[model samples]
Target: MNNQQFQTPIEYLKGVGLSRADVLKKELQIYNFEDLLKHFPYKYIDRTRFYKVREIQPDMPYVQVLARLTQKEIIGEKRTKRLIAQAHDDTGTIELVWFQGIKWVEKMLVPGKVYVLFGKPGFFNNKAQMAHPEMELYIPGAQQKGNLTLQPAYNSTEKLKQFTLDSKGLQKLIAGLLEQTAKDIHENLPDYIRNRYKLAGRQESYRNIHFPNDANQLNEARYRLKFEELFFLQLKLLRNKLLRTQKFKGNIFESVGDYFNEFYHHKLPFALTNSQKRVLKEIRLDTQRGVQMNRLLQGDVGSGKTVVALMSMLIAIDNGFQTCIMAPTEILANQHYQTIKSLVGEGFIEVALLTGSVPNKARKVIHQKLEDGTLNILIGTHALIEDKVQYKNLGLVVIDEQHRFGVEQRAKLWRKNIIPPHILVMTATPIPRTLAMTMYGDLDISVIDELPAGRKPIQTVHFYEAQRLRMFGFMKDEIAKGRQIYVVYPLIKESEKLDLKNLMDGTEIMSREFPLPKYRISIVHGKLKPAEKEFEMQRFVKGETQIMVATTVIEVGVNIPNASVMIVENAERFGLSQLHQLRGRVGRGAEQSFCILMSNEKLSHDGRIRLNTMVKTNNGFEIAEIDMQLRGPGNIEGTQQSGVLDLKVADLTTDQEILQQARNLVIEIFEKDPQLAAPENQILNLAFQAKNAGLSWDKIS
Candidate 1:
């Protein structure tokens, strides 16, 4: 029952020689017995029923038919050639066709022989047919030889089938493997967890997962395996969090002092939402605890996340420790600089901006102030992490859109000070709880789920190309009310040429409709220079231009309260999160803003669902959950880069409860055994260490 037995190479397994092993390794990544064991079935089939030919229906799913093979012949020629065999039962006849491996199939066919035929039933040319059906010689009382509750079906490629490594072949190999190793499956979970959750034993789970005795047993096996997968993942993340707090020291912001007090009382733009207040309190507690604070702040666009970040930075400054905020782009970084400057008012606290485009002379002065004690706050893009940009006791770093920056880039910021700075990463894209538990599990999380008072929700509507004129009229009405408009396109220059063309064409139509002098319109896209894009953005912001046509380049950080209408052309081409962000561009001001989604009359099902979801709700978290369901966890932004979303059985979209249970169990275990030194937990500790052997970033948020 040694664990090393599972590590044996897959080539050494019974029934698999060198050639079949090569195919399995190449096609399925099954290099060892462990990999093969974890390769669970996608589905299962019931093989107890034998259908009569008369009972066969075209709409039926996979069916088994025990009938006599009366005749066989090849139909058509060359590419169209197929081996068709006539299968007859007591009532009627059906056709079994095979277009692939025709010669091999013909060699196996025998006239007047009874066989079990299994495949999907289809009605083509007024006759029942089963294409590429699996055939086996019928034998009476064969069911007595072995147990047949449910048959496992594995995914296989046509390349594997050529070597007879299809689902049936794989099932046979798994059965043999289980016979030898099922009893040797070592238990990793403690007795307490098993008894509390009523989970199946590791050995029983593995055996039933591949070959179950009944439906209840199959369910138990699936639940146990899924729980085990997610349990280990949560254990790694929680242990990382525990180790980080113990190892990394952060500069303590013991005092709130004049800056934070002044901003909260006198200079505040608006009253804080309950959720925002809660998040600030959480940050306060973390910073006061004197431990490195690696917290993720989630809020919807215009939910006032920047305000929260600025307030936290003010606390650091009050404690006589400088702080900085890094953004993903120059525009966003500049935007944060301007917003914080205005919020701080003139001469309150010394703040400077550094970016790639900053003049050398100006950068020198800023660097001097940063090195001295004069600069209280510095904000920039990736430029903040440059070697020359040293801080005089940098205590905190607030990174906007943190995913855009690489881990190494963020790590460099930590190295700026002797004590690693507190990290507060802000993201406007709302992350579902299950995803946050797995992806950002190492970091503490806070969410500003509510928006500020008096801000109206944006009204979203979908329109077809035929209704373009009506949309234009609506835009004109909004412009008449002294509000600006944003028309965003999903344009990619290198790949989506048609989309680029669409942007240009749409701009031309806008120019013709609302010509320059009275109705000023500015055009912008990714291809434009930074200065050019900024100039266009400034024009729209200044109200000099009533309309701005651009790409998704403006999806983030270009905030104008006066811009009340967002017109997204070809809306179906965008994802749910992108569409939500685009809609957020409006509804910033007091006016009842609108988001117009324009697309072709013909729309895909997913496209329709995305549009409908946007129109139905304004809650970013709700939209995020639905988006994860539609696109899966890996495809969502910021998650694919985590490398932790590679799940085998537990789905983030559906197994939220299971994930919560696994996380809770990890928390409980850590509370009782912080070092996992308990005798029953030795296997768990070893497995956890093996799982995270070379990952150095576990200590870094």
Candidate 2:
């Protein structure tokens, strides 16, 4: 049987053969054809043209010269034979040294033979030298034509180095495979769609990505591929959402602006922001469509999502259907229940809470009530999805902070009823539109782009650990005004073998820094029990735990509006998206809030960018774009599980222009033949099925 192609590495080509193949397969997992094809060049060395040795200088990255090998000598004896060969062009001569085996070095080099060489020029003792530089013995018809063309460099497993199965050898293997792997014909966008969207062809894009042959071709390929990734991804998501909406045929909740009027007239709390009202109106329209509604409602911290959620639930109850909200953690679930339970005529809409911590008897009672349709609305954590818990006529399911729950877990809620309840997933983290479209493909999207009037944007600051005393003083001032603060860290435990600090130590430091009677403090981390966690969170909410030092377990753990300060220790340890989520914990109320990002001096370039981004904007969307740029799309969107299968050749985030073009071509081809049974769409079908099939994203991730 022919080999089953692999993906992501270039070490598996046929000629790589046993020893070298084993290195690639075991060390780097690059054991198949597909792997080599997708292994992108980290950096390219252009050998498109050449320059004389005289033109080369110290520290120049590229040097092309025609030189004669003046001499060849083995400097070191037996165990370490160091082959040193001197080659000179008309301009100057340079030493080429190899420290490993000298047997092949002697044969590869012949004195007084002129050979053209291209390598990084380094200066040593006032002379140019290329240590172990890549060389060619200038055989007629053997050397490449141009002096420099972008040489594709690849990474390989260390073991592969033993058999000389490194980048150069692997590139040799790929050149052969590509020769046999026929140039796929370009799939033209249908004349109409191409003209409409001004997009490129799918086939041409693929060819260009790997073998652009020229710069323009490379650009064309890159643009088409990126576009395809984003477009098809968006298409699949939008299509799934559209199909689900079509299948739902949900019960329409008659538009009751009168309820808003009544609530506003009487027990109303405050005016809703234009964004909140706009999102609510969108939800209202979705729910009134006579089809089940599954929407992801996103807003920044304290942007009134709970209000929108409650209003949507009210629409369901107003239509006589039951609704439930599930939170990832007890603190959050309980908090949500507290805020959502009082939206309507208190006693009019029955509400109940069930969590793992609930007493067995009370739990059974609540379960019975839920099954009997007595509870108008329910809110809880994982306890809500337990097999023992059943909902009577469950019409809507609202999940908060959708990232915390796995895809299957969220999907489980649909099975709670014969007709899957309309699922509305909410997240305080405002994912950018492109990311949201792909990440939350199974649901429709609605963004709350505005905040309520009078709500001040959270003031964000990035500080080093040295500024601890000043930060502590600032916190003390906020606390003096009767507010709270949260100090967060990255790790839960200290590794005895390692020196890096942990939350426990950070907690200890904060304890010492703020010490005793001056401030009350509570420490909550993953190691704590649920009840213990709830207890500490309760105290924090009640203003007992004046300073809460914890780990990122609190990323989605709790929402303390009164907790006006968010201080993240070693902030560089977290991702941009995570930093934003942690920051979202604060600024939940009307009072002004602040987020302090405490990073160290040794922050990575990307980490610095992430920290700088947080310091610049409270806008999650902007942060998401920056996150996408920093972390790439697959990672930024929590799509790592499916990311490999999600792409064929392009990075949806970085190569968006190419993705868009490919998508237009895909659509054009598909429109011409729905089943992709046509000759043109045949390649498209193969690409998709080959990628998506045999792929259990859950397992791989």
Candidate 3:
């Protein structure tokens, strides 16, 4: 691939000079010719049809009309002023209006001259009109340009629009670049692979993508581009996984000794589900293979992931090595420590908890034991990665809610061991399969799909504010049965912009309703200090408080078996994944639990879909799929940080088939030529290198 042509500065483009290039770079991150080329259009409009003036209707989406301007007038005054022009064809006359660029429109409008106007039609005063329609001069006896079909619509910012670089302007610039370097565009795929897929040529795809001759050409162009995008992504991810497996050697756990056997046979708390057993087998096989195991363990809340993680940790201990688990928050770290400590029993495993809140004296003793190899397992927050917290023979590292931590922090943990310990990252949020394929494709994934026996699925319901009395009665009934309740608000304090109930105000209302002696209420939110928050949480956990009024901060970490009912105030403000996680907080106990979604009578289309989806199912994966469809992959929590979903064309939600095909092809190619050293595979290597010139692959590996 010739880098010089594509690397040319955007300022040199025919339509964009230095000033416009600066705005393009800042607003859209388009710096060079290659960046501009990769900036694919979001949508397209058909340009082959021209509607007569009489055929235009208010409901028409976007129409093009060939008409001559018969009259022009400036109407209204000040900010409301607009330039209006009457245009007529053989059938009738329609109005065209421009509110902002009145002077420009006035100068462009030449009375009695025919022009082509295109825009969405709107009804004003019972007549059809178009606002800010695009205009082009009409030539007599001129041939239509090769049956032009679709016009690409590039996304532009208001800043770029100031320089006259809207979607159409951008289309013109791309056309110029394509015309100048049509021959310079290089094919990144190998000839054999392209033939197998029956894809269009790279240059041809680009030309048709920006300026297609027909719908068939446009469809072919989109297929080729989407395939190429997904193919390269899968190739990059697979190559990283292959390279890591080949280059890195891991400590081998040859035997499942006393530690693992004792836990399974004698200390086991509950029967392992089939899914759990299968996952355990997979982990055991990975550890015994003597290669670094980078695995992702995905399970919904209350799915018993901790038990699986502990069992895996025991394998490390059985091999005479220590293990450590890192969590994103101190509350979560403390919870894991307490749960694991009790489960392991005294003297079964010397487990220690280390967080910033730990006293200095306790920290000193923990550090000493860690260095002496006495602490068999350590659980902590970011404090675990401190320079002083050294581990002796660290063999396994487990990260809970791994997405919350940054890549550099994870790297810090990887460096603690000489030959990088085997990593097992766990998340309560179930990832959609398509997302897992792209985001965590490098890591082997094992999902605990089935819940443990004797657990009941939480029932979810929705309620409007008018049903507040009924909800209150239900809460009182649960409390009367010795069960606790959680009332979660979305905000800490009242916001002038949002009318939803805040935590403080909600607590006040609950206090007035429940009263003191019989009902005790606790409030927790992000605004409270750490100690204060912990106090309230402990109160709720201890059953001292009948209800806990809180924010989403309690979405994770707080697991109380007695809390059977969770009423989320203004649930419409929360996303599907968040609602699922919050619901997971309940249903921890064998008792039947319920999640009540409270909202106003009015709901937006997306808000209604989200709440409806939550009420329909408790399956985290199903909710995740819907959430991805509703908010795209970028908006999903923690996905934007991964940088893997920087997709230009292929959507993870809709293009699963394409992604799967691309992944299969990647596997076949790597299986045949792992190093891409074969003559036919060289193009794949070059393409990967050119595309990811300065990107970091540490996270992928």
lDDT of each: 0.88, 0.72, 0.90
Best by TM-score: 3
- Predicted candidate 1 versus true structure: per-residue lDDT over 1-701, tens digit per residue: 23788889999999998999999999999988888888889998765578888888878878888889999999899999989889899988898889899999999999999888878899878787899987888778775322245778999999999999999899988988999888778888878888989999999999999888678889999899899899998998888889888888778899889989999999997999999899999999999988999999999999999999999999999999999999998888989999999999998999888999999999999999999979998999899999999888999999888878777898899899999999999999998889888988988999998889999989899998899899989988988889999998776342544433367777878999998787999888898888998898888888889998989988988889899999998999999999998888888888899999998888889999999998899999999999999999989998777677878778899889999999999999999999999998988887777666677843453
Worst 10 residues of 1 by lDDT: 492-501
By the TM-score metric, which is better: model 1 or model 2? 1
Model 3 alpha-carbon drift over 4 Å, by segment: 68-92, 96-114, 144-148, 694-701
Q: What is the total number of backbone clashes in candidate 2?
A: 29
lDDT at residue 701 of model 3 (Cα atoms): 37
Across 227-328, the per-residue lDDT of candidate 3 in tens digits comes to: 999999888888888878876788999999999999899999889999999999999999988899999999999999999999999999999999999999
Give RMSD to native, each candidate: 3.1, 4.3, 2.4
Residue 39 alpha-carbon offset, candidate 2, angstroms: 3.4
lDDT of 2 by residue, 1-701 (tens): 01233342343445766676666667666657665655655555667666777777786786666688999888766767788888887777788878775677678877878777777888778877877666766766665653445666777756776778687766667667666553533343344544555556754554456555566666666655555555556545444444465565666677565444555456558888889878878887877677777788888766788888877777777666788999888778888887765566575567888887789999988989888888878999988888888888888889887676776777678778876677788888777655664566556678888777877888999988688788878988998998999988777887777445688778778778777787889888888987788788788888887898888777775766788899988888788888988988888788999999887778789989898888888788888888888877767645665442356555546655544454455455545665557764555456555535664321102
Ranking by TM-score: 3, 1, 2
Worst 10 residues of 2 by lDDT: 1-10
lDDT of 1 at 62: 84
lDDT of 3: 0.90
Error of 3 at 158 (Å): 2.1
Top lDDT model: 3
Q: After aligning candidate 1 to the native by TM-score, how far in Å is the CA of 365 from where it should be? A: 2.6
